[model samples]
Target chain A: MSASVALSVEGLAFSYGGKKALDDVNFKIRSGECTLLLGPNGAGKSTLFSLITRLYDTRDGRIELCGFDVKQQTRKALANLGIVFQQTTLDMDLTVLQNLRYHAALHGMGGKFANQRIQEELERLRLYERRNEKVRQLNGGHKRRVEIARALLHKPSLLLLDEPTVGLDMPSRQAIVEYVHQLASSKQLAVLWASHLIDEVYPDDHVIVLHKGQVKANGTVDEVLKATHTGQIKDAFYSLTQGEHA
Target chain B: MNIIHFWRALWGIVGRELWRFVTQRERFISALVRPLVWLFVFAAGFRAALGLAIMPPYETYILYEVYITPGLCGMIQLFNGMQSSLSMVYDREMGSMRILLVCPLPRWFLLLSKLLAGTGVSVLQVYVFLGIAWFYDIQAPWQGYLWLLPALVLSGLMLGALGLLLSSFIKQLENFAGVMNFVIFPMFFMSTALYPLWKLKESSALLHNLAQYNPFSQAVELLRFALYAQFNQSAFIYVFVAFIAFMAVAVIGYNPSKGMMIKKAGV
Candidate 1:
């Protein structure tokens, strides 16, 4: 399949008071592809998310989103990306629909068009009925779904999520994963889903295993598991990244 | 490209905050209580103890209660500054900061919107204080109402920007307590709020000079003049400089890449 890269990074590095958070990290997500960036805690996964989202700046490297430099064309680069951070951003006092409207306005979408898009997005997230409910009244799963809905309102080409399901019940987690895969397939949205869980990365999905801020494995699940010579993907991950703990 | 989103997001955040402010009736009322305590209790107590000769904004012998209204408004902005920053710390720990930081617009604007919203809340509180001041027979020139609006806005911006700047530096909430003791209170009392500069000069020329130089003192003086339906070009310039300096620092503090968010130590 002929495809263009939706996200591209080269020689990215960041530090804080001389502590390395991300080091020489590099990767790319092709258009319409759902790629999982798997890493353990402190493996620089969040840091990479920060840099790609322009939360961090680095003169040592470059990041281009849909062929635009993140540092230079910040607003333009951000317009092409939709991000659902692990931390919930929804205003608890606001109705679900108001949250979407605010985001639409933030993206300069207003009036009739913004209202139409808001309805369309809420329905897509299966949140049409709960549009008027304050977010504090929603369940954890529903809140997460609302965030996913908010992320989609602008129809961003590149969707990024950083450990979005860290603390949730099995049902909620499973539902999120199910919805995400469904959305990716239906919308052909290029996704860079970062997580530590191996099961989240499917057999066919492109997987990049990051260890200590560097790529230890990249390819399909079968390839990463085969490289570590482990039957279970979890065991393969631990074997490749966890030295003495193994 | 779309200010609608930016303004809408700002409205959403401000609306949420405003609702929070109103819902917590005790908090909303309490915000007024601290400044009023100083106005009625402290100012009344000191009325007989201290006497003002005359001041620029004051045409004749003025009551101490009237003299302190602008200072009280300044105090409201100052206290609200810390409150806003403290809320930012709480939001950061609560994970809500992430939601705001990821907004499509520039991070600086997002934080500015937040600051402006906070200033709105602060100004609302100041008006309430002014209402109470009116009941106590303390009032500004009736026409002064028009000029006071921009003065409030400029001072509010300076204080809001100061709050955002502080929010960007402090890593923890507990650390802010020390700031109140050393920075906030001193910044309040050391200014020409409670007393005139000439009065301070009679006591000590150095302290008077320092009080005159305090950016906050300039803000209060500008308000004093505006409330008298007059202008203070030098004082306006001084407040303008402080506002710009504070805003520049705030913009840098919230630069996203090199800001207080990255310095976060887990919590």
Candidate 2:
């Protein structure tokens, strides 16, 4: 409910028929914080993201974005959300600028303002030079950058990324990790980055480890480490999701 | 939402579809070729075998090609509708649909915008087909050409909504070919696209009734009358009502909470 709280999920649960995909999940992401959602395969990471983004409606509990209930105030809540889905959503034939402009327009931005925002995001992602290139022509890393740029076009309050670095090379992955962390602080953005990659976690980042549709641990890096009694995040994550395969 | 936002989003969606249509030369060619082939080849072959009576829209006996011109226009819209459905399925599978759905606007508005965009593209294709038919010596009254625009828009929206409904039911791209075979062919052939209701009665009473009641038949009749500078009131009402019904169901089908997205989320 606080102004800084960009995303809050309370007693959230979702199921596929009888099988629960998410169970009583609770978390709040404040502005200027990067929350790493650590979950193994089938650990409800995508389901949580889907619910938060309103891709799948919440039936069992509540979700709010920027103090607006996603269900009751969907338009306002969603207006504050920018998502980079796990898969590449860009049109392969469209140029990077075209794709970003489309996103801007969808968010109800137009003319000089929309163009200016597109340029700013593209430039910040170091993709301004290749703005005219077709998305298909870009390397995997560059395409991901464009997706990132597109997500940021509307200046959303909370950015949801669902395993965005899965297929990228190490350097690209590293660059994105750094860029997102810096972006969170610089822009006062709230970011919920879902990943199974423990190495992507930063020392200052908040950590929420999920397993089997439940939150196993949620705290700051130090708090989670202290609670789990582990020396490192890799060990902490393995211990939290002990039975699941990485 | 503000009107400006709604307008921009509509423009963005329509512009994207137009860009895609313009860039894809093969799609444009195929859209025209299908109707043209029916006009040039099928109508040519059937002209001697079938004769037309003095229908309301036709004051005198008309050639097979002339009789079938409006039907071919309906065919273009129908095929274009299904093509839009195919692309919707493709976009969903490729993950692009999520981007469109996540826009802050109402879901119904988003779906309607998409419907309108597809209808716009189909209208463009219909005009192109009509232009080519004009060259083939099939011409409508100048005012009728203008009148056909609204009819095409209505018919296109109805067919496109039907396509959108089918896309929601279609779970995978691999299943779409079967749906096209099951849906497009029957709707086209069972209707008056190739023959009149009276002609169908000569073949079978059941076919006559079915063709008489088919929504596609009404759409064709609407186009046929409009192309001749006359209005078919019953056909207009039928097509308009069908468009509303189809659009309602398509909107519901795409609803995230109650519809296909739930099934999709099961993954």
Candidate 3:
């Protein structure tokens, strides 16, 4: 594996009893790039994320992070990964700083260094002023920002976001999209963002169209558009999945 | 993982639990109130009804409240264990558990840390209950208080592990009430918590045998002896072994490959 390749999955497959959730799925995400994993509901998006995070063990295939095998060397592999789950995972009663500190401690970060990193991430997200406030006091968008800050505190090479903006307002969604895109380019962080919203895809972003537990298309935005014989991502996505859902 | 990482993760889990416990005043109050009510009202009402013989731990005849103190301590731990597991189920459903599971540590260690954290919380609750019991003039020997610490830790861990094991089986918040009705009540009532083994034997041989084998009985017996600065080897061994067995299965239940996560993944 190349040093820049932060995440690699090959021949990944998972099943719940007799029903297959992810079927021989394969993908790689490199640092300094954002990969949009576009799929509708029940398209195995969550299954793939579960596999990557080792929430469910991978049996049929292999997943590696930063050159470490996820199954064999799970500790090292996961050390290079930061994740913002689909649901808001913050402790609502705890202050924003306490929540981030808890996360940092979980990753083996502590003392002065952990506090410094926390300050930097919160400042970068423009949430430094609200650090003392309880997460329950923050709005939805601000909570998401705190989660993002917490995810980055450990400075993982790869970041996975599972439909993070599903319930946010338009402005909040746009802000997160812009922030993540900028973060990926500036920090050389590899990001695999799962979303069904076609409008969230940028022209420069790499796109992977997953449908029915299979990757229908994987390429640049322009490449997918050209390959599907469409002008817009909406058309490309519809053509790729045969208009299953937007 | 290195020892420092393991230690930090454990601290984080325990610290978060303590922070939550401090913030939820109602949780702490309710945890105390249940045992306190039993100590204050039930024990008082039953004091006249139930006459006591000289139990092994007690050199002289004891009041009903004094007899049930250790049992009530076990009750505090029992309820705290279930309460912690209830939070685990809620965390799993609310998605916060995912954050903890995804940490760069062994799943067993993470679960163990969680068990330890719950044990810590329950121990705190037990002490507070003991303190209040002291105010009610049900004081143990001064050194017995010291001995009770390790006893409480062991009992807390065993009961918390049982709760952790139960949490893995519980899929939704809705199923928790069923557990309270089924597991908690039966374990508390059938054991030596409220009555002695001889009393249970007089009532029914079946209940006597059940209470004899009940791990909660062993826990309470262990605490009962420790409260007098005495040690019951059998109860100690029983609780220790129970802790190990429950912890092993609880770890297995949380295993993603071989356990409940498989069924949960489908959800």
Candidate 4:
């Protein structure tokens, strides 16, 4: 509940039937800082995201979003966070503007203010020209942008992106990377950017390496890299998680 | 969930559902065309073959066409339930199901909102279809319009909940044609949609009891009663029980922790 921490997780656990998916995971993301969840496929990152976002109920451990318990004070907690799912959440049939307008209305913003917010968000995302375009017409990166715009409509203090840059071209990936960095800076927002793409993490940003449902390493990139004793992250990440020791 | 935010979230889900229906014109046709064919071609051919008896809520002699209106309303609901389930299968395949699963609203509210919206579209189609029936001399008492709203709401909820339940288990679209053959046709034919259950019993005791227990029969009877400037309490009870049961199952069937959402989340 400290002012510096936007999200805090302790000992999270989840299982599918009898098999464990996420086990004893722990991490904290702070204001103006972005935390990258680094793990390969089947490393339980998505399961972790589902638990943090309250998509899946958890029996073990605790998650606090912006000082509110996710399970107990769920509405207040959820209200303070905006999430971008790894999948495309936009309605393919809806125009960009219509989608954001509908999102604002769901938060019960008055129609006039919702309209104003819609205009502002679309403009901020550089998507005004495509406001009338249905999601079906947009490319993968553009659709990702729409999801980002949709997430920000309610003005959340903490943003959770589950692989926001997946499938994007290099420029689009860089654009998203830059945008999340800037957003966290400008708003003092805390971000959890979950992905296996090692390139997205900068040395100074907090990094948490999850392997087999546990936090194997967590600190600023340099600290974790130095602990793994590999000069480069890609090498350190592979050395840390691969060859049966992870 | 906050009450107002919850309600607003429901509206957003409904709006998105309606948008999906609009963009998929093929789905719209699939919902309406089969029912219209049954009303116009199939019902017209059987109007004489299906004898009219002491139908409840009907005090005097009436045409077979007039007697079938309530059953047809139930038919619209039945078709909508199955149709919505089919689209849910599509939603699962396309991955947007995750989006809905992760919404801030309570899960039950989200599911109910979908039922209400799909039912709204079904009821709207029913009115247009009813207008067609009217031009052909199949219309009911003009007084019936007064009680139509509640009737439509109940019928829509019943069928839509049933659809939600079905959608949660159905693993793929290819499995749906089997539902149409085994589930929809049997439910429609056994219910009093085209014949009175008393008469259907004359053929088989088991079928008779099944028809009486058939929730669709209750839905039809309720609509039939309302359309005749009356309300049937027994019929309402039937619908109430069916709605609660189906919705309970629907809620459990799609829950993210243990229900079908986890399996579907194979993503």
Candidate 5:
């Protein structure tokens, strides 16, 4: 509810036919911080990302980006948002630069402005030399970097990455995690990073642990550990998600 | 967004589509080859069997190739429309369509941009087919080519919108082949793309009525009339209305509604 809050979701609900995917989910992501949406598979993490990104309708409750309601003021709300989906979205046939330029155009950037922004993003990601290469030629790690750069090309205040490191080596995953952490502070961006990997959670970062379509825990990593009476994030996540089943 | 920006975005999408079209050389060749085979192979076999009266657009006997040329143009648009839809299914599966949909622009505008881009490619293919046909002695007035431009675009939009509407209903790439078998082939075989309504009526009144109601037939008739420097008011109205209806349905299907199967994202 603070002025600096970049994204806010309250009582969000969604269902697929007879099955509920999300129920009464609530959280807020503030600027200059990275919040991990830590959940196992089928925990409604992707569904929540879908709702926040306006990929699905906010049927029951509200999601706002930079104070703009995603449903009503959709254009304005989406203008402040950037997203890197779980699947690789870059056009493999196009060069790395072409992929970024295409994304910029989708956000209404053109000509000199689009070019300069693409150049800046490429350099920032250290993929400038590979800009002319087809995206398929780039390795898994570089492809993710290009995607992150594409998402940032529009200068969105809020970034939503849905299980972005799902298919990568440990080193690549660690590098991406560290890179986005740097981006959060350096760019003053509010990032909602969804992942099932327990290792991705850092003690200082905010975490929202979802289980079976419900918000099981929402607090900093240390607070989550404290509330669950656990010594580590992995154990904390386990107790919160699997305690009833166990 | 400003008009310039809108145009730029449209250009970007269209440019990517064009780039893909060029890279996929077989797509361009197949797009042309389907209609050419109909024009040369199929039409040639039927040339001796089917005779033509002096229609209003023709002052003399016309070759079967010339008669079906416009229909073949319509065929190109039809196939291209479905081709684009197939790609839409693939894009959805591959997650690129999600990127296009999440843009801050109006959904209608984005879909229209996609329609226009696909139509642009279809138009290019149509002209290439026409250019090759001209060499085969299928002649029209020089002005006919000029008139064909707008006609191709209008008909292309109608077919493309239909493709978009179909894509919205198709849940996966595998389901799209069913669309081709049920939707594409039926629409093509039942339409005036291959024969005139009178010919269909001579065969069966019910078949004639069905062909008359088929929007693909209306689109072909519009192209036929336009290519000969004539206007068919009914055909134009049919296609225009079909465009609106198809586009509306497509937009509705793509909307994140509560009960729609399309509401499921990222899968």
Candidate 6:
């Protein structure tokens, strides 16, 4: 419950029918930091994202974004939260400007202020040149940039991306990862970057390793490596998720 | 939420609906074409076989095309309602709906705004069909056009609510065609859209009773009466009540706790 914590979850639990999807999980992402939620496929990453975004109600635990409880203060909490879902959400037929404007409108930004912010964010993403182009015409990297730009239009304090780089080529993937890291540092925005790829993690970055609906490990990369008795994160991740053979 | 924000969100959703409607030319042509065919082709064929009686709103006999124009208007609204819901299903599966539901507004506000937007589009389609019918020499009183406004709005809201309710239950887009065959076809066929209630009674007592109870029939009746600058109190009551009931269930269907938003967590 520290003031610096931008996103907080305590004892969150979820299930579908007889199967448990998330179990008593707790974690926090502080302002001005990027936390890598690394887990393999089918490891409950998407489910956690769904709950955090309030797309699915939190059945058993509390989730607070910027100190506002998600369920109790849904409006305030969601206003402070921005998300880039794994799937491409841009209207394929709408121009980049139209897509961003629609998103801005959804967040209650309009008129001169919305236009100014749209220009600034698109410029920041180096996507201003293609502002009038339809989203489908943009390359994968540019489309991802547009999504990032749209996510930042309202200036949310916390940003969530669920496997954002899933289908991108290596260059686009690396660029997006780097851009998000820079976004966190420059804007003091807290970020939760979920992915199954180990290479996306850095030694100094915070990491939360989830597997089998449980948070197997959560700390700095070095700490997780130390806890799992491994020399590198790749080894630590495999050992923690697949059992200890290292 | 601030009042300005609420208005902005509503405008945004409605604008998006308009944008999509304009971009999909095929949808526009088809929406108009379906009812136009019923008015010109089907009514022409049935005009010989059916005889008109002195109904309450009409003192003299009317052509079959003239009689069914209002009903055809109702059909356009009904189809537009279902088409909007179809897009909603596509949005949900494609992840854009997730973006929409995450807005800071109340869920009911968001849903109601969406329904209103769809209703607005459907209303526009109804007017277009009426204009086309006017060109074909089937006309109502000019004042009836004004009276028809509220009737069209009410019918659109009622049918859109039905579509919203169906969208909540339809999990996948592939199953939507089945919903059309089951819900749309039955509702359209079983109603008095094709024939008067008296005519239906002559055909089958059960059909007369069923048509009397059908909400779609009531909506068409309301529209038919309003086209002559008159009102059917019973039809109005029936449509109002059905609108309330369908809307309540549709709102509940979009509730995050009960709606399609929730997915079974990956085991």
Q: Where does candidate 5 clash, by residue pair?
A: none
Question: Candidate 4 lDDT, tens digit per residue, B2-60?
Answer: 57777677777687777777778887777678667777787789877877766568877
Which regions of candidate 4 fall more than 4 Å away from where they truly are? A243-246, B1-3, B19-24, B171-178, B255-267
CAPRI quality of model 6: medium
* TM-score (all chains, Cα) for each model: 0.93, 0.98, 0.99, 0.93, 0.97, 0.97
Candidate 4 per-residue lDDT, tens place, A8-115, comes to: 998898877677788887878899998888888888888888877777776799999888888887767877878898878777788888778777756656667777
lDDT of 2 by residue, B1-267 (tens): 799999999999999899988998998898888888889999999999987898878888889999989989998899889989999999999889999988899998988889999999999988998898899899888999999999999999999999998998889999999877899998999999888899889889998998888999999999999998899999999999998998888887888788888886553
Residues A195-239 of candidate 1: C-alpha lDDT, one tens digit per residue:
867778777788887877778888777887788898877887787
After superposition, the stretches of candidate 6 with alpha carbons farther than 4 Å from their true spots are: A243-246, B263-267
The candidate 5 chain B region of ten consecutive residues with least summed lDDT is B258-267
Residue A135 error, candidate 5, Å = 0.9
lDDT of 2 by residue, A82-175 (tens): 9998889999989998998888889999889998998899889888999999999999999999999999999999999989999999999999
Question: Which candidate number maximizes DockQ?
Answer: 3
Task: After the best TM-score superposition of candidate 4, give how far the Cα of residue B79 lies from its true spot, in angstroms.
Answer: 1.6
How far residue A37's Cα lies from its native spot in candidate 5, in Å, is 0.6
> For model 6, which pairs clash?
none
Q: Which regions in candidate 1 have their CA more than 4 angstroms from the true location?
A: A1-3, A243-246, B2-20, B256-267
- Order of models, best DockQ first: 3, 2, 6, 5, 4, 1
- Tens-place lDDT per residue, model 3, A47-92, is 8998888888889999999999998998899999899998999999
lDDT of 6 by residue, B38-149 (tens): 8888999999989998786887999999888888988998888898889888998999988899989988888888888999998888888889889999989999999999
| CAPRI accuracy category, model 4 | acceptable
The DockQ for candidate 3, computed on C-alphas, is 0.76
The models' CA-based lDDT, in order, is 0.81, 0.91, 0.92, 0.81, 0.88, 0.88
Q: Give the winner by DockQ: 3 or 6.
A: 3
lDDT per residue for candidate 3 within B139-258, as digits (tens), equals 999999999999999999999999999999898999999999999999999999999999999989999999999999999999999999999999999999999999888888888878
Query: Roughly what TM-score does model 6 have, to 2 decimal places?
Result: 0.97
Leading candidate by lDDT = 3
Two-chain DockQ for each candidate model: 0.42, 0.74, 0.76, 0.42, 0.60, 0.68
